[model samples]
Target chain A: MPGMDMMDMSLMQACMDACAACEQACTVCSTQMMDCGPACMNCADMCNTMMRSMMRMQGMTPATMMAMLDATVAMCQYAMDKCMEHADHSEICRMCAQACKDCMDACAAMRESMMKMAS
Target chain B: MPGMDMMDMSLMQACMDACAACEQACTVCSTQMMDCGPACMNCADMCNTMMRSMMRMQGMTPATMMAMLDATVAMCQYAMDKCMEHADHSEICRMCAQACKDCMDACAAMRESMMKMAS
Candidate 1:
C-alpha cells in the first residue's frame, strides 16, 4: 500500500490468477508420479508463494519481490520443460506445461511492468 | 549440492517436514473462511514454498535461502497470531496455531544452522 502505489493492480491480479491456475495444474500433474513430479511439485509451491507474496505486498519490497519473481519464473520454466518431455503422450503433462508457460509469461509481464515503473 | 556441502541434512529435513505439516494445517484452517482465512492461506503458501525450496536446494544460495526463510518465518508468525485470536473457542484454530509455531521454530533452527555454517 505504501510503496506499492506505482504497481498496476490489474497486472498483479492477472499474474496472481495465472499463478493460482499453474499451482492447481502442477498439483494435479505431480500426483501422476512421472519424471516431472518433483519439478511440478516445486513449481506448484513457487507459484503459490509468488501469488501470496503479491497479495501481501505490505510485507514486500521491490528487491524482494524481484527475487521471488525470478525464482518463480525459473521454477516454472524447469517444470514446463520437464512436462514438455512427455507432452506427446501425456495429455495431463501437455496441459500442465501450458499452465506453466502461461504462468511464466504472466510473471514476466509483471516483472517488466515493475521495472518500467521503477525506471 | 555444490555449495550446500556444509549444511546439516537432518536439520533441513526436519524443517521441511515441519513446513509440510504447517502447510496442511493452514490449508485446512483457510477452508473455514474465518477471520484468519486470508492469513492462513498466505502462511500455507509460504510453508509450501519453504519446503519445496529446501527440496530443490541446488537452486538456492545462502542469501536467497535466508531471505526466503525470513519471509516464511514472518508469514508463519502472522498466521499464528491470527489463529491465536480464536484459539480459545476454535479447536481448529488451536491446532493451526500450534502447527505455525512448530514451523516457525523449525525455520528458526534451520536459519541458525545456516548462519553458523556460513560463519
Candidate 2:
C-alpha cells in the first residue's frame, strides 16, 4: 500500500469492475468449447486474482503488485487474441474479447499509476 | 472429456475439495499481513481456478488441464515456501502451508492419473 495511497479509488474501482466483468464474459465464452476456451479460463483466473488483490491491499507489496499486474496483462492479451480469432462469427467471443481489452487497459493504467507514484 | 470418461470421480472430487480448502486457508492467511501474503494470494486464485476448471471439464483440453495443473503446483510450492518461513511463529501460517501441500499433492495425483488414462 506504500505506493497505492495516491491511487485514485475510482480507478481502482473501475479496474475491479472490469476484471469481474471480464471473468464472467470469459467464463461464458469458455463454455462454448472453442479453441479460446483455455485462454479464457486462464484469463478469468488472472482477472479474479487481480481483483481480489486490489480489494486486499494489505496483502501486497509493490513488487508483488507489479508481478501480478504483468501476469494479468499477459493473460488478457492471450485471451483477447484467441477470442478475436472467432469474433467475426461468435457474439460471445466478441464480447469476451472486448471485456479482456477493457480489463487489460484498466490494469495497465493501474500499473502505470503505481509506477509514477513509486518514482 | 474424451480422456476423462475413465477418470476416477472420487479422486477428482477429493482433489477439488483439497483445492477449495487450500484457497480458503490461503485467503485467510493472506490477511495476516505477513511476507507470505502475496504468495498466498496467488495460490488462492490458482486453486480456485483449478477447482472450477475441474467442475467444468467441457471447457478444457488435455493441454489446458496440464498447464493449469502445472501452474497450480508452482503457486502452491511458492506459497508453501513463503508460509513455512512463518510457520514457527504463526498457527495460521502453519495451517495454510499444510493446506498448500495437500492441494499440491492432490493436483499432482490428478495429473498423473490423467497421463495414465491418456496413455
Candidate 3:
C-alpha cells in the first residue's frame, strides 16, 4: 500500500479475468493427456494464483512481485511448449497454448505497469 | 526453454517447498474465521500459484517474472495484515502470519537469485 500509487483497478481487473480464463483453458487442455498434464496442471494453478493475488494488492513490495512474475512467465513457457507438442492434433492444446500466451502477455503488461509506478 | 538455464533446481525446489508450506498454513488459517477469510483465501491461492510457476521454468522473461513476484508479495502483505488482526486472539492467525512472512522472504531470495542470473 505504501509503494503502490499506480494501482489501476480496470487494468488489474482485465488482467485477472484473462488469468482466470487462461487457467480454465489450461486445466481443460491438461486433462487431455499425460504428456502435458503435469505442466498444464501447474500452469492452471499458477494462473489462478496470479489472478487472485492481483485481486488483493493491499500489501506488496517490488522484490516479491517480480519473483512471482518470473515464476508465472516460466510456467507459461513450459505449458506453451507442452501444448504445442499436441497443438497439431488437438484443438484443446491449441487453445491452451493460446491461453498461456495471453496470460503471459497480460502478466507482463501488469508487471511493467507496476514497475514503472514503483520506480 | 531458451530463456531459462539460470534455474537452480535446488533453490527453486526450496522456494517451492516454502510456498507449499505457506499455502497449507494459509488454507488452514482461513478456515478459522470470517474476518481474515477473504484475504486468506486469496493468499493461499497466490502462494500455490507462485510455487507451481517456479516448478515450471521453461517460459519466462525477467519482466513477466517480476510482475508475478510483485503480485505475490502484495498478496502476502495483505494476508499478513489480515492474519495479524486476528493474531492476538487466534493461534491459527499467528501461525498464518508467520507463513506469509516466510513466503515473502523465500520469494524475495528466489527473485534476487533470478535477477542476478538474468542480468
Candidate 4:
C-alpha cells in the first residue's frame, strides 16, 4: 500500500470535522420551518456525503475528486445564500450559514491539497 | 437574488449528477455482503449528502466548499480501494468501483472549473 500523505491526512481530518459540524448544524437548522428548511436539509445530506467520501478515499481519482468538490461548492453556495436571506429574523439561519461556510471551506482545502499533490 | 455564474452552474450540475450516481451505486453495492459493504454504506451516505448540498448552495463559501471536496475525495478514495479488493470476486464490487470512479472524476472536474474561475 502507498504511504498516506501528510497534506491528505490533514485535509481529510478537517473535512470530516467540518462535515460533522455542518450535519449537526443543518439538522438543527432544518427544524426552523423557514424557506431555508429545504436548503438546510439539502446541505445536511451533502455534508454527510462529503464527510464519508473523505473517510474512504481509495476510489477517488483526481477527476472524481474535483467533480465532488464542485458540487459541494455549488450546494454550499446556495445554502449560505438562502440562510442569509433570513439571518436578520432567524438565529437558525445564522447558524446554518456558518455551517455552510465551514463545509465549503473544508472542501476547498481538500481540493487545493489534491491539486498540490497532483502537480 | 444574485445571479449564478455560468461556470459555477455547470460545475454544480456536474457535481450533483456525480453525487447522485455515486449514492445510487453505493446503496446498491452495500447490499452485496462483502467487506466493501461498510465502505459502500459510508459512500452512500456521503453521496447523498453531496447531492443535497448541491441542492442548497446558497449556504456555501469558497473555504467550506474546499473542505467538503476534500472530505468527498477521501471517502471516494476509500470506497474505490475497498471495492477494488473484491472486484475479482464480486460483480457488485466492479459496479461500485465504477461509481466511485465516476464520482471522483466528477469532483475533480468541478474543482478545476472553480480554480479556473478563481484565477
Candidate 5:
C-alpha cells in the first residue's frame, strides 16, 4: 500500500521495459497464426497490464501487485512454453519466447524487491 | 482449426460484445485511483485481447481458445473481487464489477459451446 516513495524506480522501470518488449513480441507472434497465437495474445495482454500497473502504482496495493505479478508470470510461462514448441522453425516464436522469459524474470525481481522493501 | 464456418457466430459476437463492455468499464474504473485499479487495468487488457482473438479466430485453435478463456476468467474474477470491496462507494467500480461478471459468464458459455461443437 506504500506509494512510489518506498519503491525502487529503476527496478520498476526495467520491469516495465521488459513488459513492453514482451508485449510487442507476443503481438507480432500472434499474427503468425501458429498454434501459439492464442498464448501469444494472452501474454501480450498480460504484459501490457503488468506494465501499466507499474506506471499507476497509486492505484495498487501490495496484494494487488503480487496477484498481477503471479498472473503475468503464469501467462508468460504458458506463452513461452507454447512458443518453444515451434522455436526451431519460427524466428518470431523464438523471439517471443525469449521476451516472455525476460519479462517473467523482471516481474519476479520486482516482486522480490517489493517484498524486501516491505519487510 | 475448423474455420469460423463451424462456430456459432451469435455466441462469438455476444462474447466479444461482453468483452468490449468489460474492457471499457474496467478502463474507466482503473483511473479512479482505487485499490482495485491494478486488477481493473489487468481485466481491461485481458478483455480486449479476448475480443480481438475472437475477431481473428483464424489464428486460434480450440486448445488456445480454452487457455485464453481460462486466463480471462481468472482475470475477471480477480478484478471483480477487488471491485466488490469498494462497490458501495464507487459507481464505476460497481459497473466494472458487473461487466467483469458478464464477460466471465459469456466466455464460459462460449467455451461450453465450443466443446459441444467439437464433440
Candidate 6:
C-alpha cells in the first residue's frame, strides 16, 4: 500500500500466519474452561485482530500497528503464562502455550522490523 | 476493574453482546467468498477483539479502549458498506450488513459513554 512500501512482506506474512495459528489454538484451548480459558479467549481475539489488521494494512498507520502489536504481544504473553500453569497435565495447554510463544515472538519481530523501516 | 469503577455495566454488556453477534454473522458471511468476504473477515476479527477486550477490562486503559473502539467502528462501517452492495441479491449479506451496522452503533455508543465517564 501507500505507507507500506518499505515493509518486509515475508516478515509480515509470517507474522500473520503465526497470529492465525495462535488464534486457532487459543480458541480451542479456551473451550476447556480452565483457569486459562478467559486469557485464552482474550489472546485468540487479539491474535485474530492483529492478523486482520496486517492484512488490511490500507486501514492502518505505523503508530496504530505498533499499538496493536503491543496489545497482541501482551495478550499472548498473558495467555501463555496462564497455559503454562496447566502444561504439566494437559497436552492442549502445552500446545497452546507454544503457539502463544510463537505468536508473541512473531509480533515482536514484526514490531522491530517496522521500527527499523521507520528509522 | 480498577479504572472501570465508574463505567456503565449495562451498556458495556450490551455492546459486548452486539459484538459477539456481529462476529458470528460476519464469520458465516465471509465463508460465502463474495466480494465482501475480506471486509467481512476483517469485521469479524475486529468485533471478536472488541468483545474480548471489553471482557478483559482489567488490562485496558481508557485511551487504548477508545482507540480500539475507533478501529472497530471503522472496520464495521467498511464491512457494512461492502455487504450492503450485495444485500439485494443475498440474504446472508443482508443479515451480515445489519449485524455490522448494529456493531458500529454499539461501539459508537460505548465510545460516547466512555468519553462521558472520562469527562
Question: In candidate 3 chain A, what residue range of length 10 has the lowest lDDT sum?
Answer: A58-67
Model 6 misplaced regions, further than 4 Å:
A1-7, A17-41, A52-119
Writing each residue's lDDT as its tens digit, candidate 4 over A1-119 gives 13235457777788889878987888898898787777677677776666665676644445655666666766677778888899998888898898889888988888788778767
Candidate 3 overall Cα lDDT vs. reference? Answer: 0.75
- Winner by DockQ between candidate 2 and candidate 1: 2
Worst 10 residues of 3 chain B by lDDT: B58-67
Output the number of the TM-score-best candidate. Answer: 3
C-alpha lDDT of residue A6 in model 4: 45
Across B20-119, the per-residue lDDT of candidate 6 in tens digits comes to 9999999999899887887777778778888878987754556657766877777788888888999999999999999999988988998899888888
Report the lDDT tens digits of candidate 2 across residue range A1-119. Answer: 65567877788898999999999999999899998997898778768877887886654556666666766776787788889999999999999999999998998998898888889
Better of 4 and 5 by TM-score: 5
Better of 4 and 5 by DockQ: 4
Which residue runs does candidate 3 get wrong by more than 4 Å? A59-63, B1-21, B31-39, B50-89, B101-119
Chain A: TM-score in each model: 0.96, 0.96, 0.90, 0.87, 0.94, 0.97
| lDDT (Cα, tens digit) per residue for candidate 5, span A9-118 | 88889999999999999999999988888878877876887787677664456665765676677778878888999999999999999999999899889889888877
Docking class of 5: incorrect
Q: Candidate 3: lDDT of B20?
A: 93
Q: For every candidate, what is the interface RMSD in angstroms?
A: 4.9, 4.8, 5.1, 5.9, 4.6, 4.4
**Per-residue lDDT of model 5, residues B19-104, tens digit only:** 99999999999899878887788778778877877876644556667666776777788789889999899988899999999998
Deviation (Å) of B35 in candidate 1:
0.8
Error of 2 at A11 (Å): 20
List residue ranges in candidate 4 displaced over 4 A.
A1-6, B1-25, B31-39, B46-119
Between candidates 3 and 5, the TM-score winner: 3
lDDT (tens digit, per residue) of candidate 4 on B7-92: 57776788888889888888888887777776677677766765665676654555555556665666677888889998998887
